[model samples]
Target: MPRHDGGEKPQRSCLACRETRDRDRLIRFVLSPQGEVVPDLDAKLPGRGAYTCIDAACLAAAVKQRQFGRAFKREVAVPTPDEMTAQVAKLLLERVMGYIALANKAGKIVAGGSMVGDALKSKNKPGLVLVARDVSEAIGEKIAAQAAGNNVPCRWVLTKDDFGALLGKAPRSAIGIKSSGFVVQLLKTIERYRNFLGEVQ
Candidate 1:
């Protein structure tokens, strides 16, 4: 008997914005036979997929800089900046929100300081830590130390209010975890480091 299984999803980064957001957080475009840039919202379209962040600013920059050509390694024509940005942003937001819902269902995320602290103390230290800015600096430092000692990455530690609003919920009164904020920050840092690379260049 034949068996069926869902395949693993691969990730790609946006060249223009240098954002390492998940594939879902970015829009995919492919060059059509007519050499027109076509949006591949499903990310299942045939041919090479070039990425751009969902934000209007990043999308505009990507188009202006011909980043799609760099991504596909071929000259291609794209839609108007405003139109493409709107469409891409809408799709990306929906996809990102869906992923968040799935993660919530899987019980992969946690909030609140005391609970998170206990989680860190457990044998299974959390792979990520999200510290709310509202939390005292002393407490934040302590948690950061614990995470560092456990060899876990400290990420997306922002005010609970900010994170909660993004998720369309009442204040979680904590931080965000396994979030794109960490990815964006990491990408920015990498870009800065790369810029200084071979300064002898």
Candidate 2:
């Protein structure tokens, strides 16, 4: 049943944590047409779906307990936890890149060092700043300071080439995620990726 409070998205319980949360905040999995378990990050796969919290701990629990079989009400082939983590990380990275591309098209992103710096100095600061992992420490520090002054989160996880490919430009050293609807989801996705990799607690 839909939420009586009329929440925008329905809630689902994580098979591992058994805690209910907004569906978008949980990662969905489903039995593929070929009878294999697969992550459905976009939630568009046609089949009975199971969900787990985006944390690696939850995923580990799910795998250790063989919860997928119970969730799907059948025997399902479960991948090793490491393999599943890699798959989720890959899908999350793709989702983040897609969000960046969409935000760029929507004029909600500022790419390149000069533009991002200008954005940081402006009164209307970006909500999130991303520095290329390969950027020099000095440059990255400068950008991080600016973002901190603006009370924004600065991330340095993706490579310069990754940002460039997503923005359809030359390799970018820095980028800013301006205020937009994508900011929340993008941040959540990034956090989930970090959590999955045990980078964050």
Candidate 3:
């Protein structure tokens, strides 16, 4: 599985901007059997690989300037910028959700509103506070405030129903991740997605 982390990462130059960045900061691409360019989100695809900054304009620049053809050393079909960007965003979002599930299974997740609130106030604070979108407005605001007071990152992600479905349990209004590994990677990936979408993190 691919991940975003604070630790030193593999660096590569973007085929579009020709700028060097961490591997997690760029999206990877590879040539397909049918002579077309495809995104290798996992970075596990075989053969030579191309990289691009996670920006729509950069992707467009690559297509317009024939960067892919030059890098791959052959002609290859590439999707329109809009199509490619959408696909990247979709894959990134899926990775985020998958991490949440893995964390829960690893027993690093603290679920339920009361438990999450208590965890935030304890000496051993959680790495992150995740508030379901469907949580009660008052409860959400309170938890958000608590997290802010504790200098914790509070991200409103999937709804209560969705969280429940993913964890195979009853609805969860709020949750906390206790593992440092999960927190760093989740924060990095969340920021990456937000940056790619031109949203302030």
Candidate 4:
């Protein structure tokens, strides 16, 4: 069946670029009989399928290693590394994004530092804070205090500066000066951290 203009949008994320794109723009693959790997251009398959972006290098990485083996928990022979990478990237992207969607739907998110502060003031603030590692110390401290005062735990998002780079447009500003811009996907990230902390506690 042909998809209409308003029909479902097929999406896939690139492992190499850490970007989400339309599924049609990517390649799909499935583990075939006799351990041979097969590309599922039509996306119809009986067993598990994976996807990868058009990056040949990433495809190479996927095939030379245990990427698919770990994902599927079985040693399925791949004719080419490229085939394995496509399926692994696709499966990983979907798995990650699906959890994000679930967190969003559960209202476990609060984006923007100012908005987060407001949530602190509100009756229901988050139980955890995910501050960017590159965020200014003064700003980070203040946010930390708010979380601490509320009995919320504060954690740096990651050790690498890439976390800040990946934050896109999230602002670095004085607390009372102006509002930090909103990021849709960041809410899911923060919520995931919150859940992670909950599990540890």
Candidate 5:
């Protein structure tokens, strides 16, 4: 499809929505050697790729309408709607976790509620505040208020245990990303995740 903005970025039309958008905004799927439809999150699997918006509704529509079959011009093997949704969600979550690990290794993230609160108050405020889903209500509220006061965007996803596992430490209630690049990348993945679940985020 032609670029909607006449820009350099490659665009693909969603097989379900039929709306053209930047390729990155669409999830790419390709046929595996065994003929199963597989999501290529990295867009690197070699084959004619199919596209869909990062949304459960769009995915369902595509599956219901046999859009993938038409796209491939053959009987492409696709999972049931529920299985496909779960598979795509798992892939997106993995990518989010990978970015978290990379950001932590680069020293762009600081964990613990107190540390994150401090970072929000520092001269170099954090680009984003990430709270644990299992955070204590009191501290969670405090940290959220601090992030708001600092005008930092706050997010909630994984639990304290998930944070600890990734950071190689004890459980943490929160973390702050100070690097803009990492913040941008994390938010992009999070947004896709939110869209998939139709969540407010």
Candidate 6:
């Protein structure tokens, strides 16, 4: 664990890349009593923890070099590279989904196609536009164009069913996120997810 300065969160080095970053930006792993490497996504587990950037390439390098044993300073059972990647990806996706749900609950999200379009056109523009993956190309393009015109970030990753479920609606083709502190956190989580999947440079 890296030492904290004042009230700032501690920084930790990636076991593979060895690059120091805020602990929240890295994934944490702990050695269980059974010697199994367990992901402590919340970083609340009671044990010595190893850190790794939330990236597939970094994870691959760590697995290839068998760094877990060295990090834990003991013989630990590490999952296969594929399994590890899948597990991490699953956890990240769940987190992103949870954030979307929270934004909706907090009245920070405007769902439904027309509502989102209007929100984008309003003088009080949203900070982000989320289009469902399965949305028609015409609608998606329109939303993207509107967002671009307003200098707002646009993302199309979740399916209609996924977005709808998060918003507690039947199904939505588009949604708008109001500019707020939560939007910043949501965007950061999305970027981390993209990095983990190698979807962005």
Candidate 5 residue pairs in backbone clash:
none
**What is the total number of backbone clashes in candidate 5?**
0
Itemize residue pairs with steric clashes in candidate 1: none
- Model 6, residue 124: what's the lDDT? 90
The residue-by-residue lDDT of candidate 2 on 1-201, one tens digit each, is: 465474577889998989998887888999977678899878998989999988877887898899998999888988998788777888888877888889999989999888888998898889889899899999999989988988889887789999998888899999999988888978877887887767887
Write down the TM-score of every candidate: 0.47, 0.82, 0.79, 0.34, 0.91, 0.87
Residue pair clashes in candidate 4: 50-87, 51-86, 51-90, 63-81
Candidate 5 lDDT by residue in tens digits, 51-142: 99988889978988889999998888899888899999988888878888899999988899999987887899889888998888998999
lDDT of candidates 1 onward, in order: 0.61, 0.86, 0.84, 0.54, 0.88, 0.88
lDDT of 6 at 2: 55
Candidate 5 to native Cα RMSD, angstroms: 2.0
- Which stretches of model 3 miss by more than 4 angstroms? 1-11, 60-66, 133-138
Please write out the lDDT profile of model 6 over residues 1-201, one tens digit for every residue.
556778998899998999999889899999888999988888999999998998988987897799999988889998998898888888888988998888888989988888988998889999988888899999999989989999999987788999988877889998888998777877887888888998877
Q: How many backbone overlaps does candidate 1 show?
A: 0
Worst 10 residues of 6 by lDDT: 1-10
By TM-score, who's the top model here?
5
Candidate 4 lDDT over residue span 70-150, tens digit each: 555688777576455445445544443443334444555565567678877887666555666667788788888887888
Alpha-carbon RMSD of each model: 9.5, 2.8, 4.9, 12.6, 2.0, 2.3
* Collision count for each candidate, in order: 0, 0, 0, 4, 0, 0
Residue 70, model 5: Cα distance from true site in angstroms: 1.4
Better of 2 and 6 by lDDT: 6
Candidate 1 lDDT over 72-105, as tens digits, reads 7887878777777766555544544444445455
